[model samples]
Target chain A: MKKHNFNSGPSILPQEVLQQASEAVLDFNGIGLSILEIGHRTSWFVEVINEARALVKELMQLGEDYDVLFLQGGATTQFMQVPLNLLDKDAAAAYCVNGIWGDKAVKEAKIFGNVNVVSSTKDKNHSYIQKDFSVPSDNVYLHYTSNNTVEGTQWHTTPNTNLPLIADMSSDIFSRPVDFSKHSLIYAGAQKNAGAAGVTIVVVKKDILGKTNRNISPIMDYRKHIEADALLNTPPVFAVYVSILTLRWIKKEGGLVEMEKRAKERADLLYSTLDSLPVFAPIVAKKDRSLMNATFTTHNKELENLFLEECKQQGMIGVKGHRSVGGLRVSMYNAMPISSVQALVDLMIDFNRRNG
Target chain B: MKKHNFNSGPSILPQEVLQQASEAVLDFNGIGLSILEIGHRTSWFVEVINEARALVKELMQLGEDYDVLFLQGGATTQFMQVPLNLLDKDAAAAYCVNGIWGDKAVKEAKIFGNVNVVSSTKDKNHSYIQKDFSVPSDNVYLHYTSNNTVEGTQWHTTPNTNLPLIADMSSDIFSRPVDFSKHSLIYAGAQKNAGAAGVTIVVVKKDILGKTNRNISPIMDYRKHIEADALLNTPPVFAVYVSILTLRWIKKEGGLVEMEKRAKERADLLYSTLDSLPVFAPIVAKKDRSLMNATFTTHNKELENLFLEECKQQGMIGVKGHRSVGGLRVSMYNAMPISSVQALVDLMIDFNRRNG
Candidate 1:
């Protein structure tokens, strides 16, 4: 079966990227050496790291003020690290808890310093991003998840915060261009829109560092990683390599502008199909809907099961929603082909007609 | 060119494992979906995690007493985590500082609690593991690195300690079977003997968790990970899957006993060849020589360069020594074929004949 993958993360990558990545695993850069076997400190591997960092900056339009770092651990580690490296033990960091990912960030930040949850839609069951949060003036920084893969909510616009804004853009980074100048730091786990898992890319404005007085471990210290150029230790070489491939793919496919256009189209098709279907109901408020993950549900459980079964039979994979939010979710990340969305829409329409 | 890879970590995997991993990235387990595209929470991926976990336990001959975990952030994260989860803020942890990795472990542990340097070979430039270390009586646990990839030192035998023993076998795990009952915890970054980068396999005694008074991040808490079956967050699915393939390869090639036998043969050939070469000198004490990484150097820089250049020309990759310890390092890891070591030996012999 020709599967159409809709996994939220550790998610789909470009076929070309997969092919190229696989070849590198066997023989990286025609060196007859598997990427897994290359010394990270070697000139060739260093070039791979440098090129990948450069591509991220180029794609994100980040300037010299921003230092792009490929660190180990995932966005979860950054949850604590951001606070550990930024917030003083006595100070507090403002967090907007819009969904599960945001909730996690807030939870992790609390471990290091005081966490002021400025706004939360947890009361609303995380149905949408809270747009009217009053930013705490005294807080170290404002933290928010760009897109909620589980709740299927996304911030349509940047939060108005004078503080250094830190965004966990794990689910929606690079899907569209944003003002990199507006935020002090942006982190994304590569499993989503980037390339692969294992690496967390943090683009930090260098000046934002060295404020926290806590004794941070070298691995957890953003300054240490930035100074070492993300080679403080042996990095996730293959993950970084694949990310570069994905970045190149993004560039070849016309960068974020084109990516945004395609993402909007895919989300529109899927949402419109859901809205039109009597059996299926879109979960999140349409205005705050995520361009990356589309969460929905059918009125009938049997029909929902049948729809998922039929979708799988029709070569659609990972359409099942998170257990926390038990429903169907189609994560149309940057690598997700629009045709895959169309196929899902067609299947939904047919299923609604047959079962309704 | 046929490259003979001897990288310390992010090291070479079996060619067949690489081939399988590459194919799976395009299409996993005949699911018609790329492995990279699958949701980790899905039953399909959950099975991969379980199987990988099960394989580790099986390989180690570990019973239910040990809980296997697949974690991110590598052993560096674990350095702090092990103390954060196990050590009370008032307690001390004993550390045997044999090499750079052991020193790093001690440094990271100091952040959480007092770290007692039980013994150290720093006086001798970490040339060998100090066999006469006294375990601190008041320490909560004793920590050591089983094999030093950089310093090229290996513990010929496990240190006797009354306290809970923790080993960072990052470079040597699964190369051979150790007495797991002797240690309360053993953690390894999966780039060397196991499989690839991004994932850290930690086998911890279940009872030792939740003793610390410190507020630990959920990701840093080993019990939380074990409770979640190592799916605390989205895992590096591709890395885990490749590790599973590598584990299967190890099993098919007759398990750890066979691996140890092959490792000994390869290391013996390389070490003996280095010893016989009048121009070159092996760095580590013969009794403490690493069965995984063979480090050597020459008195003459020109001769060293010539040997390295000749080896590179003859398809030996990653032979350059670590910059911190400048020389030549031939890391004959578990997946390294003995024939490759023979080829390396032959190259060294030919080079010596010309240079001598």
Candidate 2:
């Protein structure tokens, strides 16, 4: 049975990516050793990391002003490292608390320095994005999550601000195109759209670093990682290789322009189906709905369970919503084909016909 | 060609482990979703992490008194995190600088608290281990590297200390049996004997945590990781899965006792061959020579290059020494069969005949 993977992430990746990755695991680039066995410093791996870095730059249309780093500890680690490098005790950073991830970031930033919550959607359980919020001109930087994985909301437009911008694009990176020049730093855990689960991609404008008065640990410092070309220590070699393959796939499939086209189409199919069904309703406002994660809920618990059970029977996996926000979420990342969304729409339509 | 891998991690893994890991990447445990695409929070991955943790306990004969954490950052991250969680401003930690790794740890530890270098081999360029050094009874914990990957040294015996002991076992973990009770914490990057790059295995004695006066970052805090069952946030799922497969392979091959037997046999064969040859000289003292990484060199640079060229032509990989130590290093971790060592010995003998 073919499983339609809607896992929020370490989620769905392209079939070709998985195939190449598996083959590499056995014999990477015909090196005779598994990609798992090769040293990170080896020329083969150097090519991999370098190409992956280059692809990120190519996809984002990033100039030489930006530096790419593949670091460990995921976006969670970045939550702390970001402020540690940018915020000192005397400096205040502005945060847009639109979802759980943003809220968590705000909490971590407060430990490093003063964090001003310039905007928050906590009042409505993060069901919408803040379009009317103000960014403090005096703040060191403004931090925001470009897409909320759990709540299914995305910032379609980069927040216009004079201060530096730091965005966590964890769940939606590579799903669409972006104006790379607006942000000082953009980080994404590769488990989502980029590749596998071990590596995190951090793209920072090189000039934004080294200004902090706080003593950042060498491993935690962005400047140190950038200076070392992300090989300050032994990196996640295999993960980086897989990410390189993923970046290649993104480029091969006509880059972010095609990804954006597919994302919009997939989201349109699912969202339109849900909006049409009397039994189901979209979670976020239509204007703020995430193209990456299409979330919806049914008022009837029994009907919801039946629909989920039907989804499972039909080989639709991970459609169940995050426990925090409970009905269903279909994560349509960059690799999620329109066919998978069509299968879910078919399932939803069939279920609604019987239960409506 | 069936290449002989001698890379000092991310190094060779068992053939069966590689085959199994590769299969899992495509379809894990017959689940429709590729392992690369599955969510970390799913039952499949949860089981993998749990079993990997269990294998660590079973192999080490560790009781429930210890907690196992599969983290993201490599040993370098642990260098600072170890002290951040264990040390405070007023406290001091004792260190035994054996090699490059120990020097790095010392530098990182000094950032969090005062470090007392109770023993150092820098006096002799870390070519030997310290036998006469004493652990400071006043320090919070005594830290040391179990095996020096770059310098090719290992501590055959643990330093007896009244205070807590923390070890960075990056290169030698699982190469032999260990007395699990002797240490407060043990960390190893999984690129060596365990599996692949990305995941770090941290076994911390439960009683040793939450004693520090400093505020540990949430991601850096072992206590937080422990409470969350090492899933404090999204773990390196693919890396952890591969680690699980490697752990299973270790157990299937009769665990640590067989691994120790293989390690000793391979090291003895390679070291004996180099030691007997007039063209080659072992780098570290025989007493401190690492079973995992066997370092050797010749007085003549041309002869060394000729030997390396022959080795490479004969399908021996990763024999090149670390740049800091210009020579040859054959890292014979547990997965390296004695046959691989025999192949290297044969090549060295052939090279010596033509050059000697």
Candidate 3:
């Protein structure tokens, strides 16, 4: 069966990336050994880590002032680590609660220090990004989620804040070019658009570290990982290797500019199809819609089930919406082809014509 | 050139496991979608998680009293999490500092609450496990590493202590059958005998959770992950999948009992070869040699270099000693074939004959 994957993440990856990753798992870089078997300290493995770090810096256009680290535990770990390393015991941190991920970040930060929720759209069930938020000058840093996977909302513009800005770009990283200098720290779990799960990429402005009074563990401290070159402990070797391959794929596919163009096109096609269909309506405000995860709903439950069933039959996988807000969600990450979106659109049209 | 992987970890896996993993990465279970692209929340993925968890329980003969979780951030994260989740603010934890890893666990525990070093081999450069360790009666738990990877030492018997027991079995997990009921919690990074890097398998007694007075973030809270069945966040999806395949490999190759027998045979072969060679001397105390990693050294730097060069020429890799303790380390994990061990022995004998 011809398959089209629309998983939010661990979503689709380029075929070339998959092929190269497979070869490396068997024998990395013609070293005649599985990537999983190599020592993290070995020149070969170190080069892999170095290249992956370099690629992140190059792709993001992060300056030398920024430290790139590939750490483990996912973005959730970062949620705690950010405060553990940055938030002083007596200080407070500002968070903009845009969606589920944002809420998680706020909850985690609160464990370390006082958290000020600058803005929130939870009353409306996070249907749109809340704007006109005021940043607390007393807080050490401002935190926000770049794109909400569950609510399908994105910050179309950067927040105006003087406090060191920290962004969780797990779902939307590398989808487009952003001013890397604006944020003091940016973290993204690799499962979404970068590569696979297990590795968390953190880009940190070196100045933001060492200011907090908390006694941070080496693994939790971004400065520690940066100093050790992300080899503070044994890293997630294969995950980082695939992330490097994925980054290489991104570079070959024309970097952020081309990625942004394709991402916009894919989301537009799917959203346009949703708009044309009476059976479906997008959940997020159009102006605040996520280019990565396109969420929609049908008023009739029976019709929604039918659409899902038909899509599955056509080998369209992972289109089912999150249980928190049930309907349908098509996550069009960088690797998801436009042809797949077209197939999904055709299925929706055919299903609507037959069952509407 | 044929490569022999002796990396302490992200170590060698069975070639068959690698082949199967590679196939899945390209097209998982004939689903026409890369395993890398599958949604973690899907029923299919849930089945994998469930089966992996079930397999761990079955292998360890763990009952409903235990909760098995596949977590991220390796055992390093657990160093802090174990204390944060179980140690009350007023309680102190007892730690037997056997080696580098055990020392690290103690350091991480101190971040959360009072930590008492009940005993340590650090005075002697951690060349042996301290068997006469005393645990404070008031301590929350007694933490130890089952085997010291760098020092090539293994605890032949569990410590008798009144407190709850926690073991970091990163280097020795699944090498032999263990009494799972003996400890309150057992955590191992999957890179050793389990599978690859990125995931940590944690088996905890359910009753130990929610007792700490400190606020535990979702990522650090074992209870949160256990309640969510280890799907609290997007796990290292591919790493977990590989671990499942490894468990299957273990089962097919005769469970832990057979694994123990094979591991002993390999270790004995390598150690005996070292003993017979006057040019090389085993590093660890003879009474406490590790069945997973065998460490040895030659006083003659020139001869040691020649030996290592010859081993590499004969397809032995990752034998270089740890920087902290310079010597040769031959890690013979469960996936290593007896033939490979025999091959290394042959090389060692040949080198000794020429050098001695």
lDDT, residue B187, candidate 2: 96
Model 3 chain A lowest lDDT segment of ten: A212-221
Candidate 1 segments exceeding 4 Å error: none
Candidate 3 off by > 4 Å: none
- Model with the higher DockQ, candidate 2 or 3: 2
- Interface RMSD, candidates in the order listed: 1.3, 0.9, 1.2
* Alpha-carbon runs more than 4 Å astray in model 2: none
Per-residue error (Å), model 2, residue A59: 0.4
- The CA lDDT of each predicted structure is 0.87, 0.89, 0.88
Candidates, ranked, DockQ: 2, 3, 1
Candidate 1 global CA lDDT score: 0.87
Q: What are the DockQ scores of the candidates, in order?
A: 0.72, 0.85, 0.79
| Chain B TM-score of every predicted model | 0.98, 0.98, 0.98
Error of 2 at B18 (Å): 0.8
In terms of DockQ, which candidate is strongest?
A: 2
Tell me which residue pairs clash in candidate 2: none
Candidate no. 1 TM-score: 0.97
lDDT of 2 by residue, A159-192 (tens): 9888999999999898888998899999999999
- Kindly list the per-residue Cα lDDT of model 1 for residues A114-224, writing each as its tens digit: 999999898878987788868768988999888998999998898888999999999999999888789999999999989898888999999989987788887788888
Candidate 1 local lDDT, residue B161: 81
